[model samples]
Structure formats: structure tokens, C-alpha cells
Target: MDDAHRTRWTRRTLDWLRTEVGSALLLVGVVLVALAWANSPFSGAYEHLWELPVHVDAGDLRFDMDLHHWVNDGLMVLFFFVVGLEVRQELAVGALRQRNRRLVPLVAGALGVLTPAAVYLVIAGRDAPTGWGVVIGTDTAFLLGVLALVGPAMSNQLRIFLLTLSVVDDFIAVTVIGTVYSDDVRPGPLVLAAACLLALWLLGRAREWRSTPYVLVVVVLWGATVQAGVHPSLAGMLAGLLVPAASPEREDVVRAKHLFRSYWQSPNAGVARVVGLGLARSISVNHRLHEQLRTPVSLVVVPVFAFANAGIDLRGGALGEAFGSTVLWGVVAGLVAGKLVGISLGAWAAVRAGLGELPDGVGPGSVVGGAALSGIGFTVSLLIADLAFEDEADTQAAAIGVLVAMVLSSLVGAFAFRVARVRFGEHSADLPVTLTPDVDVERDHLRGPAGAPYTVVEYLDFQCPFCARATGMGQDLADHFGDQIRYVVRHLPLEDVHPQAFGAALAAEAAHRQGAFWEMHDVLFANQARLEPDDLRGYALELGLDVERFDRDMADETLAERVRAHAESARASGAQGTPTFFLNGVRNQGSHDARTLIAALEESLPEAAVRRRS
Candidate 1:
């Protein structure tokens, strides 16, 4: 297929995934089917299915694995690649971008991992040291699903905290699997693997811009890692790390847009193809690959893995023995008790040390609930169990523990969250949420007619992806409602998490001085990963602003203070995260996507509130 066709297909696939939340549901269904099949009279058929031999032979090169191992080691490589991309993006642009913001989660995740292992050792004794890695990870998919089901009534900051904590722990767990679990290291293959990694990094730094060499290197690196007795899956993470996470250079973006515009006017197929490819390249490699791969890995690969691995039969003696076994007790205690106490205490200590603060509208109790939620560790936990226990009986016992811990942890978290809700009442959630002060046509950023019947006060961070999406939706709403809606913008730069956010907010504020706040907003969101001082100044110059005045305004303490004051006001008014919108003085619930928000506006406002677009 041609480049344009491929791009269109990829975009459609990603769009579909965004609109559907079927992955977790599908995984659950597959697990249920696996369980039924395993306990049926045809249980031998289910067991034999996974043990069926698979082999590849090509001259001196050969590989052999059972169906189950292939699913774990071969198919799951894609899943790990997507994970690596996520971690890379977080470090480059998301919550982990700042060292101080990362510190709390770092501490929490370390303690979460260590405490669980420690608990496992204590319960199972030194004889079971090998299985101690079983309780180290959080199931991101399941946890995020639970949070979504619980809704935005909970503090959004808690969700972010849990997400960051899980991501850090997942990376650490992957590292442990790669290094600690490997049976032996072959020196020659290990050295070659190191060389391959170095070459990949150098190629990325040199901006080779071609995929052929990178793909070859990745294939070789995976093989080398496998030969070295390390898990080959680590190669995916190494490759993802080498991917550049910044937007393309300013010149490159300009050139690509120019080429696209030229092709638009002339209608040349060849020029259009080249422009398509160039536009694709303008996006970061990590983001591009992530967008393409996330849906397939989640929907197909993950469910397939669960179907193969989640089929432990609960026969008469097996179930009773597993319940009685020390290994099972260790797994349960490690994941349930260990994660809850460890993460909660870590957060508490972080606050005591002044290293971290709780999310607005969330208290210490809610944090403990969030800690309980962290105990649901199925995906990565199963992986560790498989690697740790070579004996079939031991592995089955460990699996039973993981399954029970997952269910118990989920229930405990839900119950704790309920308790927090009842105890804190309005304190646990943003209640009677109202618009932050300083949201005004005269004082703050404004879009659309000031006298319009509908007013949306958006507390936004210039660096946030969701806020960027909300900004675009705001534009569409303006176009849809004509002059019947007014948009107000307030700065709530999550500076601690997003390092460039404070500076970006300042730049927009400075541009507002030159009557170009919206122009600067567009530039910053379009190039979020490339928002250094020089880039901000260059954007001002490109937009025909006085460079000297823009720089002076950005550096002005009063302007910065104004932005900070607005942020503080937002926090006081119960804002937990960015892109929070208040429509007519009431918080907007649900997603801010164009369709959803438009319907919400229609319901919230009167029939005569909007003027239909001509």
C-alpha cells in the first residue's frame, strides 16, 4: 500500500480505539471462557492446546517454544513496546518530566515494590525467595478502568498520582524480570546486545530518519538478548527509549506545512504523498508508534495472553490445598496488605517530609483508598509468577493467590473509597464546584462574544494534552454556536508535573499583552514537546510580535504572579486537574470532546441560549 493509504488506515484505527472501551471487557470475557474450558470434561484439550510445540528452522538459526511461551515472550513484545513508548512520553512531556514531581511516586513505587516482596519473604520464609517478585506491579488497564468507573467525583490528582506510581513500578518490574530472573548470562551475546543498543542510540541522535536501519538493529538486538539468556522483551523498551520524543525542528514543521499547502493548491499526487510522509515524521516517533500499536496490543494481544494464562483449574484437592498453602498466603498478603500499607504510608511520609502534597479535594483517607487500588496487579504479577516458580504446583498456587488478591484488592479499594466519600462528604470530592474568580472578559483570555448567553470558564494548562483537546473543542463550539457562547481561559499551570508548563503559560500571558494570546496558545500546544525559551521567543517573532517586548513581558513578575494567582484560585474552587470547565458557574461533567460537551451545553443552557451557525 501507498503511504497515504497507510496513514489513512492508521488514523481510522486509532480513532476507532478512542471511541471504544472494549479492551478490558474483552479480556474479562476471555478469562471467563478460559476458566470454563479449563474445568470442563475437556480440560485436557485446553492444557494440550498450550503445550503444542511450535518451531522455526532456518539453516543454522532455530527457535522452539510452546504456544503459551510464544504468547508471553513473542506476542507480548508488542505490549511491552507500547509500554516503553508510554514511559518515554511521560518522562519527556507528562507528569514525570520534573524531578520533584517524580520524587513522590518514585518513593511510593519503590516502597510499594519492596514492601510487597518483604511481606512475601516473611510469610513464605527464605525457601520461597525466588517467588518474591510476584507482587511488584499494578495492572494499569484494570486500575484505570476502575478509576473511570468511579468517575470525576473523585479528585483527578489521585488518578494522576496512581498512574505515575504504576508506570514507575512497571518499569522497575520489567527491569527486575530482565536482570534478576535470567538464569545465566552469556558474555559474548551480552556484549553484542550492548553494542546493538549503543548503535541504536547513536542512530537516533544522528537523525538518520530512515526506518530500515533501525528495524534491522531492533531484530538483531532482540535475538542477542535472547541468546544472552536475558528476556528478549527488554529490547523493545531499549528501542522505545532511543526514539526521539520531541516535535520536529521548527524548520522541518514549516517545510512540511509549506509542501502540504503547495500540494493542496496544485493537486499533485507525488507531492501529496511526500507531504503526508513529512507530516507524519513531524510527530515524535514514540507518539506515532504508540498511537498505531496501542489498540491492537490491548484488544488482541492482551486478551490472547489472558486466555492462555488465566485457566487454572480449581479441582477438589487443588483448590483447597492452594487456599492452605503458604505461597498463596504470601501472595495475598504481599499484594493486598503490603501494597495498601506501603503506598499509603509512603504518601503520608512524603507529605510529612514536604516532598509531596495530596490532590485538591482529596484527603489522607482517599489516598489510602488509592493505595488499595494499586494492589490490583494481574498482568505483570502473573508474568513474575511464571518466571519465579518452575514447579507447576508452585506456579498454580501463585496464580490462585494473584487472582484472589486482584479481587480482594478491588473490593477493598471500592469500600475504602466509599468510606472516604461518606466521611469527607464534600471534602472528598469537588462539591458545590464554582467558577474560579478572575474568569472575566476584561481580565482573562476570552474567545467569542462577551455578552453571549453561554460562558465556559476553562482552567487550563498550556502543556496538557487534554487541555489542548479542550482548546480545540472550544474553537469548534464557538463555530457551532456562532456568537452565542463566550469562552474564558484561566491559567492553572501544573508546573511541578509538567516542567515547561509554567513558562508556556507565561508566554501565552505575554502574548495576550500583544493581543495575540490565542495565537500563542495555538503555537504552544502544536509544539508542546519543543517549548524551551528559544522556541517560545521564536514563536513570538514568527507571529509578528515585538521580540523584545514579548521577552520583557514574559519575564515580568506581575504577569507571572497573575497567572499564579489564577492557579491558586482554581485550586481553591476545587480544580484538581487541567482543562476543568465551568459552564455558567457549574462544573462540566463528562468528557470535553466536541460532541459530548456540545450536548452537555445544550442540556445546561436554555433553548434561546445559542445562535445557530449560518
Candidate 2:
């Protein structure tokens, strides 16, 4: 794709992943097409096409597998790698980063796995106990998609809970695939695979940021895994784990902007290439791969896998026999009934034991609904079903069971959420939507004209380096719009991470008493590393403020409370990090770059004003 198309597709894909309904519908459509083609006169062609041999040969190495194996072993590697990236991200900075926030979901997820496996074994022990792993996973794509369709109007809290739970499920599912379901052991190749994995670890430890090195290593690792007779999915996941995934550092962002400015001034291929590479390097490789790969994997790789695997020929009494067998009912009960009970009871027990509390807005009914939706286990469930059962009839039965469970679980979840809304009156389980306690000129420290037509409000922590960089971007916006834009900054001192932030906010407020708030603001951002009490006092002296009055005001409890109030307002406005922006009272969804923010401001202006400005 061209850059424009690529950008648009990536944005749409992220939105679909976030909202979840579109991708699920696409998956469902693909599955329907597969079934239709399988049952049609072209049915014979379906199996024949996938069974065609694929061959790969190197100078002294050769590998051969059918198209089906290629899909399972090859393209699916990207899917698992993306999953691993997400898991790593969660562990680093997402929901699971906080120990207390992660505890309840971890407990519930573990139980969710065990309970389903237990239920499956109970129902199908004598017949197909090995297939218990089939029900141990929840397909994140389908779960989120169906949840969006059937969940509460505002389900962010519950969504985070379920997403966190799925991370655990994914971990166990991949472990089972690699160990419990691998082919016969091959020690020499397995040893080589281990060495490759160690190399990956070493690269990460050494902070190797280049994507090319990681890619080369992963390719060799996958080949070793295939030769080792272990499932390559595990190799993919392990490689992903070793790929660093960190948020962009402020210094790196500033460097990227500098590189861009050089390219802007020179406008040559070499500088453009340098600028591109610089921008890419600012973002972690793991995050970049996830963003670029998730869409194609969801839309293409997964649908192809489904088409290859989900084509069950259920004619000639096959459908009746499949349903009649214990395997089908075992999967149904294990996923649908077991997941609901296990997750619900697990969450309850965790809360009772004070392990951790549920996310803020998720009520019990929402949890119940989310747990039911978790039963929609399609992708990994089907993969496990194929590995768990050698008998074609057994696999067919399990596949039918999965499809049936998806429909049933969706219905059950919808019913639960409906009951939640109507009976318990629990609705809107997400963060506050609009800017809370709308900005006032008298209250907020404002830049630009007081009566400016356009407004941009930023929630910032004085000690946050990102916030420091954002100060320049804010100035750029002010420069572009001049008196037409009013810029406001609210204190959102993340005291846990930025210890001196609260004190700095109070210092700014104290300076406001001497008509030097802007002076202190510029000084604090400029010298973010030194924000101790003594440093604040020094800054007041530097700003020509009355030192006695400033120190007394900084000591005032009411100033501290004002800072606290601003922090509370930031939270109420759904800002969890520094440098969150609100444009014309609406939250900015993506980047807060001057260009993007300027475009938004121009769009909001009257047509006559915009034309005149242009």
C-alpha cells in the first residue's frame, strides 16, 4: 500500500480492534464463505487445494509441507508474534503493569482455564480427554467483537478486565501448543532452537533496536523450531517476547522532530530516508510490528486459516453423528457454561479475599456478561482441536461445537447485559466522556487571548518529560493561531511516578498569586529535572516574585488542594497520562503533534475564518 493508504488502513484497523465489531463480522463472513464453498459442488476442490505440497530448499537444507501445514506453521507465526507483542506490552505498560490492577484478572483467568478444562474432561474423559485443551482459550478477536455488539453502552472497564484475562489465556494456550501438542522430540535441532532463543535474549539485553537483526534471528529460530519438531508458534511467541516494546522516550521524540525539521529544510531523498528511519526508531520495533501486522493477520491470515481448517464436510448423517457424540457437547458445556461459572466465581473470590478490586465502572452484571462472551473460543480452540484429536470425526465434532458455542454464548451475553441495564440499572461503565468541570478563564492559567474562539486544554505533570516536550508543541499551536487559540494547562501530577510533580504544581499556583504563573510554568518545564522545594523557591526568586509571599503561598494547604482538584478533573476527563489534549472540549484520540492539532482546530473553525486564515 501507498503511505496514505497504509496510514488509513492502520488507523481503521486499530479502530476495529478497539471497537472490535468490524473484524469479527469480517471473520464471520469468511467462515460463512468457507462453509458455503465446502458444502457446494466445489467441496472436493477445497481439501485438494489445501493439501497441495509446498517445498522450500536451501543450498544444503530442504523443507516440505502441505499448504495446510504452511498456513498452520508459517503465516500463523505472524499472528502469534503479534499476540506475544501484546502480552509484552501489557506486562510493560498496559493494564497488567500495575500489580494490584492485574491480580483479579490473573486469578479469574487462571480459573477460567482450569474450570473449562475440568468441565471438558468430565464430559469427554473416556472418549477424548486429551481434547480438554481445546476449550482452554478465548479468541480475543471474537470476544471483543461480540462484546461490543452485546455489551453495555460504556464497557471500557469490563473490556480492560476481559482483555487482561485473555493475556493469561493466550500464555497458557501457546504453552500447551509448544509442549503438550508438539511432534516427536528431536534433540539436536531443539538444542539449536534453545541457542537461537538465547541469542534473542542477548540481543534484547544489549538493546539491539534494529528490526533487521531481530528478523534474521526469528527466521532462523522458526526453521530450527520446525526441525526440532516443536510447534513454531512457540518460537514466534518467544521471539516476540525478546523484542523490546517501550514507549517513546522524550529525548528520542525530540530527536525525531529535529530529524524531520532537517528533512523539511533540505527536502532530499537522503534526508527523507534519515527522517523516516529516525521516526521509526523512536517507536519500539515490537509496537511497530504489532500495528503493521495486526490488520493483515486479522483480515487475511486468520480468515485463510479458518477457510483451510473450518471446512468440515458434514453431509451423509455426519452432522447428526457429530452433534450426538460426546465431543461436541463436551466443548459446548466446557466453554459456554464452564467459563461463565469459573470467571464469575473467581472474580467474586478474589474481591472477597481482597486480592484486587474490579476496574472502576465494571459492575457484577457486566463481568458476568463478559465472562459469557469469553466462551467464544474459535481460533486457538480450532488449532488445539486439530492437534488434540487425530480422528477426523472427532475434529469435526469439536469444530461444530465451537461454532455452536459462539452463537449461544453471544446470545447469553446479550441477555446478561440486558438484564444488567434493566434490572440493576448499571449503565455506562467507562471513564467520563467529556471534559469535566468545563474550563473557566478566571480559574485556569491561560495563554493567548481570553476570548479566543478556539481552545486547547492540556493535562500535564511538571516532572513528566513528555509534558516538557509538549510545552513546545503547545507554543507552536499558539504561534500558529495567535490570539485565536486559548491554551490552558491543568495539573495532573502523577505523584507515584513523578514524585516532585505535586510540589511543582503547587509552586506554579503559588507563583500565580504574584502574577508570575506563566513565568514559573516556563521555568518548571525548562528545568524539569530539578523540582525540589528549594528549587521551586529558587525559581520564584529568579522570576522576580516576592520570596516571602511565594513561600507562604506554596505552604498553603488550599494551593495543594487546587492541584489535587485539577488532578481529579483530569481523571474524570479520562486522562491517565501527562500531555492529554482536549480540542474544542473533545478529547484528542491520537497524536498531539502540532500539525494534527492544527488540522483539528482549523476544521472546527467557521468556514469564513478558515478561508481567511488560509
Candidate 3:
């Protein structure tokens, strides 16, 4: 190569090296720090740093958490947030967009996740199933690092395939972390987290995607997550997803147009307008923080987290004990066995049933090999291990098993792909499948008189006290407005805490069968405090329904299915909780009195009045 070509080549090589080397170094640094802190003479100080008391209070609002918990629960949320972003990006434009490419990785990931989990469970048993999640994640950095070292031996297609698989793996891991390893239930913190997320999203949409508000919101969300008995890392995932990642070039153009308009409208305005002008001058200022948030999270947050949590001291026969322990073995087995079995079965079923086809340039052997690699569960496994085992020794053992399983799975996956490449001769073809975002909405109930000018949609959960209040108020509005406003009640039961919510919903549907829906609706809301099955039936009889019909319908599969469909619809419409309202298709998801709803209804009315001409 010539001197100029050499220079260009060297620079390009350095850039690639930087990315690979930087990520590796960061991962190594985290492990070293964690190991050092866990075993060092200054371990106390290291632990204390994480345990230091941090508090934020404004008037009556005050919250606190130790340093370590903040990092684990709070900072980890940001990690998950980034995970969500990657997922959204992949679905929008990456490997996940193609059905063929997507299916194989998904199948591979499913197998990878299940096998290890099964291995862990069979070893650990039902009591330790929580630890199953521990052996169910793929460590993106470590896995990618291994691939980079193998370099030229691996094809670019394989590398992309691995990346896509890892992204899906991360998605599953974060979900497990959020749903499975969560703390006890509390509405206050949950509500706060929801509000913060909404605020951040609105700020982004209004072109006010500044870092300050986002950061503040994240902190509050973290605190709320801690308070809500959920792993605080969930807040990070929520915040990250809401932060837009449109390029700086586009942002600059938008900002310039906005500023020009503002200046044109107020030529003679004083310093106040000029200061306001400064705010509009650069969308860069506002967007700079959000951009930083995304970059640092991947480069710093995730790596540090991996290092801190991944380290386990391997002295005093800890390795031997880990192998001996059923919990450890269970985790290892679940990841290895469950992943392979579940994934292979799911894939085979999909293909045989004609629901999906294998990817091009990929064969059954490659798929199986990839499935083996999918058994490499590290990140999520550790998280679940932390949750499942309160005993330090047990936890360490599970971690050791995870580390071993991950390495073995990755090796198996890489080898499998290599064999497939040799056999299939790189005939890459896209798989055929339907990929649609899952809609969780219930659309079964009466949608109001066909072309009614106004539609009032109410989200109600049988267990929520606020929803009960809204039910009574909604009925009043419906009666008063008559033909002017059509009322539509949507199911949105909070099932996580209230286990019987679905049953309660079924009871309401049963009453509806006997032409006493509004009456049963009132009774359910009125007596939300005491919603036993018998109580619901009693209310049905009091409302003049045939008691036998109500009982039969309550147990009816058709009625239950309809209720479930409605609940799904509510979720799709963004109804996170009960007592949410919507006026003529516009969302109004929260508690509001009759007057407030009326005002909203009037806003949608036409300017011209209807007249009776003689």
C-alpha cells in the first residue's frame, strides 16, 4: 500500500481498535474494581462509598437510599433504559426488521435463555426458581469481546447475527429484572415513576429535550422505584426509551426555524424577549444532555455495572462448593438445558407448523449451535441469583455457575455457526414471518351509538377506589348528557397486586348479560371494598338479574374472554391505571370530576349551533 493509503488505513484500524479495546478495557476495569473492593483491605471503604446516605428533600417530599443500593437499583435502571432503546432501534431499523433474520435469533435467544434456566431449576428445584432468571441473560460486552478476538475467522453476517441475538437477550434480561426481581407493591412510587416518564416524554415532544429535566426526572424515578419495591434500574430503562435520538443536524434546522419565527414575531421586545430568544437559539443546548445520557450509559453505566456485579472471589474452595450445590447446578442446568429445549422446540414448532421458516445461509445445525450459545446467560442470571439466594455463599456459587455456563454456551454457539458456514456455503436468505408490535387493548364492549358525536371512554379497574369514584361520576354524566355523549367503559384492572381483579371483571360482564350492566357497574364500584364472588352475585340479584344467569355467565368462557380482550385494549391505549378518561378519542388518563370532563367535552363541540328552521 502507498503512504497515503497506509495513513488512511492506519486511522481506520485505530478507530476500530479503539471501540473494541475501549469496551474491553472498561469491562476489565469494572471486574477489577469489584474484585478489589470485595476482597481488599480497603473493602470497607469501597462498600461504605456505596452505602453512604444520599437524601433529597423539598418541603414535605423527602426520600433516601444507601449509596450501594442507589447504584444497584437506581443506576441499573439507566442500564435497562439503554437496553430498551437498543430494542426499539433494532425493531425500527436493525436485524430485527427482517423476519428471517429476526426469527432465528429470537429462536436462538429463546433456546439460550431456557436451557440455562432449566439446568438451574432442575438443580435448584421450585423453591429456587427465582435464581432461574440469573442464568438467563447474555452479557453483550463479554460475548462481543470474545467475537472480536476471533475476528477474521468469523463472517460479518455472523457478527451481525450475534449482535442482534445479544440485543434480544438483553431485552429479555431487563424484563426479568423489572417484573421478576421487583420489590413489594406500593402505589405512591409507581405513580411517581409513571408521572416522571410522562413528563420526560412530553418534554421531548415539545422539542425541549434538555438533559436537566431528564436527569432530575430520572433521579426522582429512581427514588420512586426504590420506594415502590421494584428494582430501581427499571426507572433507567423507562427514562432511556423516552429520550429521542434524532441526529444533531436535524435538531439544528428545527431550532433555527423556531428561533427565526420567534424573532420575527417580536422585533421591538426588550431583554426578556432576547433572553427567551437565547433559549430558542440552540436546540443543541437542550438536546446536548439527552445525547450525552445515551452515549455515557452504554460507554460507562453498563460496563461499570457489569464489573461491579460480575466479580466473585474464587478462594477457599468456592468453586468446588458451587459445583456441589444444587442451586448453582440448577442455574447452570436451566440456562443450558431449558434454553436449548425451549428454543429448539419453539423453532421446530414454528417451522413445522408453517408459522416461520429458517434464515438463508443458515441451516438447522447453525440454528442449534446458535441455540447452544443462547444458553450463555450472565447479566440477568446474576441479578436473579442476588434475589433468590439471601445466603452469600449460595449467591457466589450461582454466580460461578453463571460464569461457567456463559463461557461454555458462547463457545458452543461460535463453533456451531462455523460448522453451519462450512456446510451451507453462505447462502443468506431472509426468513418469512410477520413482525408486528403487540397491541394490548380491549375493544369488545359497546362502542356507543354508531356515529355519536361525542364518545367518553373510561378506564376502570374493579379493585381501585378511585375507579369506583369515577364510575359513579361517569354514570351521572351519561344520564345528564343522554344522546349528546356516548359512554364506553374500558377494562384496566391492575392485576399485579390485586389477584382477583380479572374475576371481578368477569362478574361485571356476567351482570351485563342480564341487561344490568350499568347497575352492576354501580354496585361493583360502590362495594369495591368488599368484592368477593358471593358479594358480586348478591349484588346481581339485588339489581333484579336472574341470579342463575349471573352465576353461569360469571363462569362463562365467552364472557371471560371478552373481558380479557377489553383489558388488552386498555393497555394498548396507554391506560396504565384505572380511573383514566378519554374525550372523543383524546387521552385524559387520570382522576377528574364531572365538571372537568364536561369542559373537555365542550372543547370538542362545533362552533356553529344547530337551529330549528320553520
Candidate 4:
């Protein structure tokens, strides 16, 4: 095959691996392979391989660790770095951006961790208190995969709740490992580590998106932390947080454009390279690193860690040894029973006491199921088991408990998710969607009167052929119902699938400024197949819009953000696809034909409200 085909195939494969189900399956498969290898006659090979040691010394610099330690203490740092990046993104722009919005997850996750650890301490305290931390984590990839297995009956709320909970869980786990579990923490090295962190912060400001100084500082930070007897992986979080999450300055974007134009016009190799560098700086460093590392971490680093760590011999009475033992059963109880009770009750108390609220569409049964699934604490639990136990027997027994807990937890979670799907009748997860035609009348385009009794809100991509099918529905709604129902258009562009969708939305938005949004909207949908950049400008001219102002408005990044915010609002409010409609604040699912739209309007709107057109 050609290089292009090979590159495309590689991209597809990496994307697949980065998905929840794909990562989960790969992780589980590696674990299975490890189990099989450890149990087979070739078990000696597995043990010997992980036990192999490597050492490095260069003048004053020295590093020594075994293959297993390297995987756990060394490679796992990248995994934690990715976690830090995710948390930063959430706090910076995603769901947890707002303080009140963050409260629920923070409360739920805090309770989730404390309850599990408390349960473990109560049950295993006298004999195995150290194992408390083992039950405190939730494996995000595995939990998400389990949810995926339950099918679309799972709502986005459950996914978000679980994800937020896991991010918090990981943070707690790392902090616990670094502070509570480290037996030899020295203040001197810790002070040095803090100095390195200061250096990291300074370097980040001086050279945004430059990895060299950051890497050097992080390397020293890791060594210092290791010397200080804290888990070296904590250095990764420190490094990750230093990477900026905000958008770059406009000058940066302008510089990138200049470089790109220079490269295009002059066609020099150096200019082309500078263009690449400039464009990289224009994007958020957190996002760029996250994307660059996700595939490799999911496909390579995680699987290797799982393979090295998950190998517990099932042969030679190992099952009997663990099944009959208190340490094993205590861990199982803590993970399975403790997580379920903790997440459920913790969330309940938080919600009841006004600290948190249940996510939309998620009822008690779904919460119970989700809580049970959080018990599948594979990655961090295994790490805890390693840290908490010195004896091989104890470690293997804890591993067995982790394995059993994971299996049982999944079954329980699936059962709960299925129950939720049946109880809620599949639509329980969707939030109520409403759009006030008068609210964003100036910001968004409106075809009919803002105060029409029955306002029809259409969330759609301009390039969507299905949206094109619904194009006539708007005019027909006006034609049939007259002023009784006014049509309002909102952009929900899917730029990945349709490259021109965002540009089309921008064209429509720009036209709204010139009081001709409907005109641009009509033409764009009609000729979606030809919405190139120049075609959009031509459409503005054809519609008699101020061409220069239209161009300036289209070029406005803030307008793009407005369009993006609208799309995100559409998603968060549970508009599943393009051509989604809401009549009188209620979503109208199914066919978007005029008849369906009219029928939905009749069913959803009160007669008094409909009669308000007079």
C-alpha cells in the first residue's frame, strides 16, 4: 500500500485504541495474556522477565530499577500525566469549569473515596489497614468500557458522573501514595523537588509549548521525588499542571497565519517547518500534548503496565489460598460492597444535604449500578496492592481480590444499568431541552417573530443532507401555521464529518448581523454541497449583505466560539443529532417532516399558549 494509505490506517487504529471500549478491551486482553502466561508451564519466563533489573549511571547521574518497578514507578508517570491533563481540561473549560457545577462531582468523588477507604478500614483495619487505599480508586477506562457494553441505554450524564468521579479518585490515590504511604520522605529532597517545580513554572511562562526545559525540570523533579521517598509519578502531575490550558493570544494565531502564507508563497523548507511550529503554539499545550500522548499511552504504555502487573498464578492452590484468606476477602468486600454503598450513600447524602445533585436522567437505580461499576478499580488498585504489601503472597492475594472484584463489579453495574434503561424506558437519560426564541434573537438568527406563541427551535448542521430535507419544513411550518409558530435556527455543526459546516454556520451568523440570516441559511442548505469559503462570500453578496462586514464577522473568532457554545449547549441539553427540534421548550424526536413537526406542536403546546398568537 502507499504511504498515505498506511498513514490513514495507522491513524484509524490509534483513534480506535484511544476509545473507551478499545482501551478497555486492550487492557483486559493484556491482563488475560499475563494471567495465562503466569499460569502456564512458561510461568518462569514471565516471572524472570519482570524481575530483570536495569541500571544506569552517567558521571553524577544514576538510575536503577527493575523491569516491574520501571513499569510501575517509571512508565506509570505518563499515565498520571495524562490524568493531570484531563483534570486541567475539565477545570479550565469542560464540565467542571463552574464552581457550582463542580460541586456535585467534587462532593460525590470525595465521598466515593472516603467511603471506600472507610469500609476497607472497618473490615480490614486490625489485620490489613494498609489495604484501605487499594479500594479507593476507580478505573475510568474499564468503567467506561463496561458502560459502553451496556449500550446506548446509558446516558451521557452517567458517563460524565463516572468520568468526573474517576478523575477525582485518581487524584486522591496519587496524593495518598505520595504523602501517606511514602515511608522515607526526606524534607531536603522534597525542598529540591519544590525548587524544580518552581523552575517548571518559570520555564512554562518563558517558553510556552517548548518541551525541552519542561522535560529537563520534570526529570530532575522525578529523581528528587524518588529520592525524597514520594512516588515519582507525582512529578508528572506537577509538570502537566504547568502546561497552559487557555487559548493562545491573537498575535500567535496571526504569526501562524503569516508563517503559513510565507511557506505557501515562497515554498521554502525552513518556512514550512516554521509554519508547523507556529501553528503548534497557537493551540492549547494541554490539549496538544493530551492528543499526542493519548494513543501511545492507551496502546503501548497501559498494556505493558497491565501485562507486567496483572499476572497472578491461578494454579497450585492459589485460588484456595486467596479465597480462604482474610486479606483477599477483605479487599473483595471493600471493592465490591464498599464502593457500592459508598458511592450510592455518599452521592445520596451529598444530594440530600444540598452538597450535590443527581445527574439528569440518572435515577437511584442507575446510581447504584454506576457505583457498583466504580468498584472495578483495576489500575490504581493494583498499584496500591504493590505499594501496600511487601510479601509476595499478600500481593498475589490482593491481586486475586482485585481480579474477582472487577468481574463481580462489572456484572453488578451492568445489571444496574440495564435496570435503569428498563425503568426509565430509554429516554430517562436525556435532559429536557428548551430554547427561548426571544432570548438570543439578536445573537442567533430568527426567521419568524420572536414572541410567537409556538417557537420551533431547530438545531442542525448546514451541510447535513437530513437538515436539507428539513429545510422546507421551516417554510412549511410558516406556511401552514402562519405566525402561530415562529421558526428559529441554531447551528449544531459537525465540523469533523462536514468540513464546511462551521464555515457555513459562520456565514449564516455573519448574515444575521446584516438582518438576512434566513436568506443565507436558505441558500447554504440548498447548496450545502458547494459551501466552500468563496462560495459563502458569494452567497453573502447574492443576499445583498455588506460583503466587507460579513467577511470581518466571519473572521471573528468570538463568533466561532458562540457557534461552538451553541453546539455544546445542544449536546448537553440532549439533542442527539442534526435536525433535532424543540417545540415550546419540548424536544420533538423522530421524522422532521412538516406533519411530524405539526403533530409534535399540537401534542406539546397547550392550546392557550398556541392561541397567544392573536
RMSD, one per candidate, in order: 6.8, 3.4, 19.6, 11.6
Tell me how candidate 1 scores on lDDT: 0.79
For 563-608, candidate 2 gives per-residue lDDT tens digits of 9899889888888888888887877767878999999878766784
Tens digits of lDDT, candidate 4, 548-591: 99999999998899898888778766675687887777667568
Query: Best candidate per lDDT, number?
Result: 2
lDDT by residue (1-614, candidate 1, tens digit) is 99999999998765644432345556667888999999999999999999999987656757688999889887877777777788878888877886667778768878898899889999985657788888888887777666555533555667777878887778888888888888888999889999998998898788766566776887788778777888866777777777667644556666786888889888888888898888877777667778778878887888888888999999869999888788999999999999998998887787789886655565676777778878888888888889998777888899989889978887888788777777765334333377656366678778888788777888888777667342467778877888888888888888766899899989998998999999998888888788999999999999999999998998899998998898888877777678788877777767877787777777776553555532
Task: Give lDDT per model, in order.
Answer: 0.79, 0.88, 0.65, 0.80
Better of 3 and 4 by TM-score: 4
Poorly placed runs, candidate 3 (over 4 Å):
1-22, 36-63, 95-104, 107-112, 151-156, 159-168, 200-216, 243-291, 340-369, 421-614
Put down candidate 3 lDDT per residue, 1-614, tens digits, no spaces: 99999999998754554465456556656766777666766666665666689986867766676765555676666667666566655664566866765776676566666665666667676645557677777666555565555322433445566667677567677667777777577988789888988988887687664466767877788777777887765666667667654423434444555665666776666744654655543534324444445556656666666665775766568778877888777766666666656666766766776645664334566556655655666665666677767778888888878777776766766676566657765333222111111222343344346456777776778776555243357666766677777677767777875766787888878877776676777777767667888788788778888998778888889987787777766655555566777676766632477777776677665542232221
Q: Report the backbone clash tally of model 1.
A: 0
Which rank order by lDDT, best down to worst? 2, 4, 1, 3
TM of each candidate vs. truth: 0.79, 0.93, 0.55, 0.73
Task: Arrange candidates by TM-score, descending.
Answer: 2, 1, 4, 3
Q: Whose lDDT is higher: candidate 1's or candidate 2's?
A: 2
lDDT of 3: 0.65
Per model, how many backbone clashes are there? 0, 0, 44, 0
- Under the 3 Å rule for N, CA and C atoms, how many clashes does model 4 have? 0
